[model samples]
Target: MATNAQLGADDDYIVVRNPSKLADLLTARNVDPEVVTKYLHIIRGDAKDCYTVGKTLYGINLEIADMVVSDVGGSTVVKPNRLRPTLDDPTICQDVVSNIPNSLKRIELLFKATPRTRRKPYIVVISTTGISNHGRDIAVAMDKKAMEGILLREIQTGGRGASVIRGFTAVRPSFLTDGKPVGAQKIRAAVEEEGKVAKSAIGYTISRGDVGAWIYEELVEDNAAGELKYVN
Candidate 1:
């Protein structure tokens, strides 16, 4: 495996020829920045941190390029460019599960172990079951993690295979004015369910409306590749 020191310059850019070389160069034991950067390079981006290099089969951005690198004993720890994960827009279901540890307690443990950066490190759990009608996946893991006082920031229900029904009807509620109204009722139900899921997932109380900003910070605006802007 080719290490970072072995990398060659390609017209002002550093290139790592071998893909597997990155794993060897980076220690998987913890959040290493050097490993993350090498991982980013292996994944490839335009001018480093300009845009995510890979995508999942679902069109989700898989490799987030923007990262904060911390030098740790000849290694680097790479994390989301920003401390938080975004979730405001409702359209982009951030897939942060891969970045998280296996269990819910593992998340809390990891957060406590890692050193704090400029921003507070809060964990946002996105439900991968992909059940939108069940409400946003962000809430479940978020709530579980927040039980320790971490804050559940934002919730979104529904995804590619998810539904957005508003509410449930008890015995049709009068079949007057056409059944088309039922459709609207379902939509409302879905929206309301999303809210409920968000609340349920948080497991703790947050300042009202703050979840929106937290979601936007970690998810949408903090583009991984966008970090190149500061590199010069």
Candidate 2:
């Protein structure tokens, strides 16, 4: 089981939408309820909306350093960039000296400071239907080889924004429908096994509540540690 401390408070989790579901699951499991309330963080965007999802998920930012330039003949010449921490840059030494106290200050600041933006391991929920050619008959359509290909290439590429984190467990669930909580017992989950399909692995339609419970029971509880799993 990964602790909030091991995975920093701010960066421990990267949920996409309806983070409340993950929180609800964690609470039911008797894990630290406050962990979800205080530490569980989310990437703000919709995965379906690819256009701006990356910016929202990663919170893109840019910093421009001041550049030194001189006029050489008719052209403006910019100074060559120097390696950081070189003898020419005394600021690097100063930074090293200052970081110790700053580190201590950061610890103290954690109590009041807004959670810093950092990447950590994540359990990403996605659709098996996205990869399967068949709609409800995805079980037959998704073979072991096809599952591997979708996970490796398609999912990897589409989810590249969240890939910067340590790693992620892609939870490929069957058809999802809104209803009462199905409870963890009703859900079936397994690692990417060849020949596994919707009917053989688990049921076809899974409730959103059950999906949440499965994430907590299987992925989070077992400490999946970055792997792909199918659930229903």
Candidate 3:
């Protein structure tokens, strides 16, 4: 999702990205400088105090966040992205899950710290499309290792360990195409149950922009994608 869009609009965000191209990134996203000051808290790795624009970093930071999003997968940890996965290299199926042990604890604390209010925050993630045996019948189990890793993040994060921070939703899309948004209504979304997201059998592929629209509908427009509890 674009930072200038409703994805980051009027919301306090912990923006973590390659800080070297910070200006170009914002320009590409069409975000104004003022918008950066109004809502974003960038985690500038290494360049000490170069961009300490936000006041808070650790304390109560995760707690107040409106959403906990994880876009990383198995390929996230693999270095030198030029090469494909090899059968010999183990731990390829769960790079993100394995590295997020500390983050899991932090997520739990965020859930626990949730205020006694009507609205609750959500944890959303991008999982692979082959998890429920619905998409790409040809891809072998070994090839879908990244998908497996991503699905693990969704399921594990939805468990009692996190304990009611908000609803959790996982979008397991097939090959992502780049183009104009296909619109969320065009998506044949998988049925969401208590703690499960059934795979969509009919849909073979979805555009990245469509995925963003789907997320906006789920998170912003209240067409939520999972079990929810709106307390009074």
State which candidate has the highest lDDT.
3
Better of 1 and 2 by TM-score: 2
**Superposition TM-score, candidate 1 onto the true structure:** 0.18
**Model 1 residue-pair collision total:** 34
Query: Candidate 3: worst 10 consecutive residues by lDDT?
Result: 47-56
Per-residue accuracy of model 3 over 58-142 as CA lDDT, tens digit each: 2232333345444543333335653654444344324433323334344445555554221334555566564553344325223
Per-model CA lDDT versus the true structure: 0.24, 0.40, 0.46
Candidate 1 segments whose C-alpha is farther than 4 A from its true place: 1-119, 122-130, 133-220, 223-232
Q: Arrange candidates by lDDT, highest first: which order?
A: 3, 2, 1
The per-residue C-alpha lDDT of model 3 at residue 193 equals 51
Model 3 Cα shift for residue 32 (angstroms): 2.6
Candidate 2 residue-wise lDDT, 1-232, digit = tens? 1233333434332424566775676677688976665754455433333332322222222111011000001112235653322233322222322222232233334423334433333323333443533334453322222323332442255475533233334456666678777688966665544554444555567776787677666655454343334322
- Cα RMSD, each candidate: 20.7, 19.6, 7.5
Candidate 2: which stretches are off by over 4 Å? 1-5, 8-37, 40-123, 129-151, 154-168, 195-199, 224-232
Model 3 residue 177 distance off true place after TM-score fit, in angstroms: 2.5
For residue 38, give model 2's deviation from the true position in Å: 2.6
Q: Worst lDDT window (10 residues) for model 1?
A: 166-175
